[model samples]
Target chain A: MLSIRDLVTSYGNIEALRGISLDAAEGEVTCLLGPNGAGKTTTLFTIAGILTAKSGAVVLNGEDMTRLRAAEVVSRGIALVPENRLVFPRMDVEDNLRAGAYSRRASAAEIAADVADMYRRFPRLEERKDQLAGTLSGGEQQMLAIARGLMARPRILLMDEPSIGLAPMIVAEIFDIIRELNREGVTILLVEQNARMALDVAHKFYLIEGGRITFSGSPGEIEQDEVIQRAYLGSRQG
Target chain B: MIDFIQNTVDGVMFGSSYALLAIGFTIVFGVMRRLNLAFGASIMLGAYMGTWLHVHYQVHVLVVAVTTVACTVLVGIYVERLCFHAVRRDAALASMVSSFVIWMQLEEAAIHLLPERTYAFPGLFAAGSYEAGPFLFRTEQTAMLLLAAVMVGALHLLLHRTRFGLALRATSENPLAAAYMGIHRTWTVLCAFVLMSLAGGVAGFAILATDQQITPFFGLWATFKGLIAMMLGGMGSLPGAILGGLLLGVVEAHALWYLGAEYRDLSAFLLLFAMLVSRPGGLLGQRILSREELAFRRV
Candidate 1:
């Protein structure tokens, strides 16, 4: 379980996340749906400790992780699949996956086994194991990014905009992967602009607007809300 | 023909030291994407420490070499902490300017410690020349060449076959993503500085030991030569650095022989200018991809 309480993060004078709080329960997918510039990515970054918070706390289970750096955050079992699927462009797919497990103190044999598991999970990666990650197709790169995050063996995975630029079919496939990951008992905190797809897999969803959580509800409750219908579903007939 | 071949041979032997120096610069540049102008000054200070030890305490050549490398690493850490670590990452110009100021400070510090225009640097090997098949090789230059090769081989292994090297390369490729992978950016950059400083110290020793002398101008000379070599070979490529150094050395040697010493530097710069016009990427440097091209590749 992860609890974020009144987290405030800023960039100079502009506050990107102004006292926003949310939670992702254990073994569940919690989706944050927001428009562009709605502090979606900023919230994920602040939770991953890539951006330091101005105030409040990020408690994973119970321990305070508010002041930890990104490296420490990963070591504490929170791995972020950053927006844009920012895989190491020049490195081969295998090395990129190897880099994913860098924070763990696992032995070579153990790490190799985990890498093998990734290869089995995503066969396309194994096929292009020796190819530079940048050369992979957009869909393949997204898979590699997910596999890389999974390589960290985190207690919770935070994925930001994994389907942002992918094809429609690939977006569906990515959501399927997300559902499978959750089914396998990995907790997930996902940020998405695709409310429809995210709502299908997410156990609970929160709608964020202008750096604040405007709505939070079950998938059924969300479907009946007029604001969700007009703003997210693009339907005025709600 | 014999004269040309002889100059080339001499150039190559001397160029090994240049290659070592270029490697130092390239490694730091590769990791940080910022220039540390104080690289040469740090090496100069380290060499000054060695020369002081030799002059006052009459230490062994081995002791001087160790002192030089250790001191260079210390000065390098100081520069990293003050100029690089203190500055904002996005303000690369600030880091460069800070390093430039540190270079002046380091050079002045070295001069204050020695207060001499020139001092003798202890040679690693006895003064002698070997004649083989009508070619002459100085003992120190030969040693430099051999050591440079060994160092390059060792460094290649360290970069390719080690976990630390992987982390370093990842950091160089993408600092933010590397952080997501839990690679400590500051620690990795510090390690890179220390690694390059070790190489720079050895390079400074080799060059000084071969010349058997040191002066305040050596810092400027080392910086320019290393910078030019790095640029010539391609900025960040390791092999490019080595190739550039050898090419610069050979060209300078021929110039010194044919056009006189005045044209030596001129010829080297001219080659760099021509290379820039013809192929701006250098002999082995890859053309950097534009953001659009990179995005296109992903799709």
Candidate 2:
């Protein structure tokens, strides 16, 4: 389980997240949805310890991880699949997966086995295992990024905008992977711009806008709500 | 034909040291994306430290080289932590300023310590030239060449085989991406600095052995020759730098033998300029990272 309490984050003078609080239950797909500049990525960055919060407590599995550095946060079993799938450009696909396990305490053999497992789950990656990660198609790179996060063997996976720039079919494929990942017992907290798809995959949903969460509820309950309709779909019923 | 052959041999031997200097320069530039103008000063510092060790303590030449390199690494790391890291966030001006400040400080310090005086560390090889047909090869030059080859070979192994070396290469390609993957940014930069300083220390010994001098200003040619080679080779490519250093040496040697010794500098410059015009990226220089890979976004 992960708990973010009264988190406030700012980039210089611009407040991206203002005193927001949320929880991501274990093995559940919790998706945070918001329009552009909704502090969604900021929330993820704060939790991953890439961006520091001005004031808040980030409790992951009952430990305070608010002030930990990104690498240290990773060592503590939290891996971030950053937005845009920032895989190393010049590195081979296999090497990128290895980098995912960078902060792990596993043996090389164990890591290799885990990689083999990933290759099994994502056969496309296996097909292009020796190819440069940068040259992979956008969808493939996104898959590689998630697989890389899985390699870290993190207790909780934080994915930011994995479907941001992909085609609809590719986006569906990504969401399906997220669905499968959740079913197979990975605790996921995904930030997404695609409201309908994110709601379909996530168990719990949080609506964020202008650096604060306006609503949080079960996907079914929130989807029926008027504010949810307006906030996400920009209700323009004639 | 005999004169050409003799100059080629001499150039090949002398170019070894220049190649080492280029490797050091290119390694730092590749990783940090900053030019270390003071790096020459680092060489000067290593030379002074090694020579001081030999002159005062009568330490073995190997020990002098090792300890001086270690000292330079510490200096490099200290500079990284206190100086470079702070401004690292700025990207454009910080590292350049960091290198500039260190260069100025080292220049002042070197002046205070040695004051342009050239003192030699005792040569590792006996003083004699062995005859090859009618051409005589100096023993010290041959030894220096062997040492240069060893440094280059050792670096090749380190960069290709070791985890530390891979990490350095990755950092050079992209620092932010490396950080997200848990590669310590400071460690990568420090490793680069240390590698260059090792080059510095070896250069000190090479200069001392090859020539009979150790002055504060001794490394200017090393910097110029090495940089020119990197420019010719392509800034980011290792193999290119090696080839470029050899090319520079060959051109200079020919000029010294046939075109008159006064044209040595001119010949080297001509070669470098030709490379710049013909292959602007050097032989192996990597262009800037792509926007998609870096995940570029406008603010």
Candidate 3:
């Protein structure tokens, strides 16, 4: 479980997230939906400790993790698949997976087993195990990024715009993967633009805009709500 | 023909040391995308520390060399912590300017400690030459060449065969993503400084052994030459650094032989200018991560 309370984050003179609060319950996918410049990415980054929050706290399983460094956050069983799937382009697919397990004190055999498990789950990665990650297709790179995050074996997986620029079929496959991951007990904090697809997988949803949580509800409630229908579904009549 | 062959061999032997220096210089640039201008000071530290150990403490030459390397690595860590790491997030330009200040302070320290314009460096190997067929080689020259080769080979292994190496390369390629994967950025940067300083220290030993002189000003000269070799080979390419140093030395040797000694320094610049014009990336340089790629983008 992850809890974010009154988080404020900024970049120089610009405030990206102002007094925003949200939560992702254990073994459930909590989706944050918003248009561009809504601080969705900023919230994930602050939770991951990549972007420092000026105020408030990030609590993971009741432990305060607000002051930890990015790597320290990873070590504490939280892994972030950043926006744009920033895999080390020069590194081989297998090596990138290994990097995800960097802070683990596991033996070489255990790490290799985890990598083998990843390969089994993502067969495409296994086919191009030795190939450079940068050479992969956009869909493949996104897969690699998710596989890499899973390599950490994190208790919580925070993904920012995983389906961005991906083809529809690939996006469907990514959502399927997300459902499978949640079934396996990996709590997810998902930031997405595709509200329809997100609502299908996410147990709970929060609509964010202008650096604040404008609405929060179950998928059923969100569907019936007129404000959500007008803003996200874009008027059924039109 | 024998004379030409002999001269070329000698040039390569000397060039091995230059290659070592360039390796030290370029690896830092590869990882951090910022020049540690105090690199030459690391070399100077090795020389001065080795001399001090030899003269005052009566340490064995081999022991002095090893200790000098250890000491320089510490100095390198100190430099990284104070000059580079402290202001790392501010701007790349900040680290660069801070390194210049560190280099000045290091140079000043060297001068204050030595005071003498030049001091003789005691040789580890005995003074003599060995004959192999028609070629005569100095014992020290062969040792320097062997040391450089071994060090470079070891460095190659470190970069490829170890987890630390993988983490370092990962961090260099993407610092933020590397952090997400649990690679400590500060530790990786510190590791790079340690490796580079070791290379510079060995290079300093080679310089002291081959030329048998140490001066505070030699730090500046060493930085200039190492940087030239790094550029000639390609900025962040390891193989390029080695090849660049060898090429520079060979060209200079030929220049001295044909055009006379006065044209020696001119030869290196000519080669660099030619490389810049023909291949701006250097011989082994790839445009994989350029200044644009490494630039800090404000979120």
Measured against the true structure, the TM-scores of the candidates, in listed sequence, are 0.94, 0.90, 0.93
- Could you say which candidate leads in lDDT? 1
Query: Residues A56-127, candidate 1, lDDT per residue (tens digit)?
Result: 899998999999999999999999998999999889999999999999978889989999999998988999
Best by DockQ: 1
Question: What C-alpha lDDT does candidate 2 achieve relative to the native structure?
Answer: 0.82
Query: What stretches of model 3 exceed 4 Å from their correct place?
Result: A12-14, B1-5, B288-299
From the highest lDDT down, the ranking of the candidates is: 1, 3, 2
Screening candidate 2 with a backbone cut-off below 3 angstroms (N, C-alpha, C), the clashing residue pairs are B119-B214, B233-B282, B233-B283, B234-B282, B234-B283, B236-B285
lDDT (Cα, 0-100) at B186 in candidate 2: 76
Residue B207 displacement (Å), model 3: 2.1
Chain B TM, cand. 1 = 0.95
- Pitting candidate 1 against candidate 2, the one with the higher TM-score is 1
Give lDDT tens digits, candidate 3, residues B10-80. Answer: 87888888898899988888788888898888678667877777767788878878877887898899889
Q: Write the per-residue lDDT of candidate 3 for residues A68-178, one digit (tens) a residue.
A: 888889889899998999999988999899888887767789989999999999999999999999999999999999999988889999999999999999999899999
Who is ahead in DockQ, 1 or 3?
A: 1
User: How much RMSD separates candidate 2 from the native structure?
Assistant: 3.7
Estimate, for each residue in B190-295, the C-alpha lDDT of model 2 and write its tens digit. Answer: 7788888787567656766777567777656666877898788878678877888787888888999887989999999888788777776777776545787567
Clashing pairs in 1: none
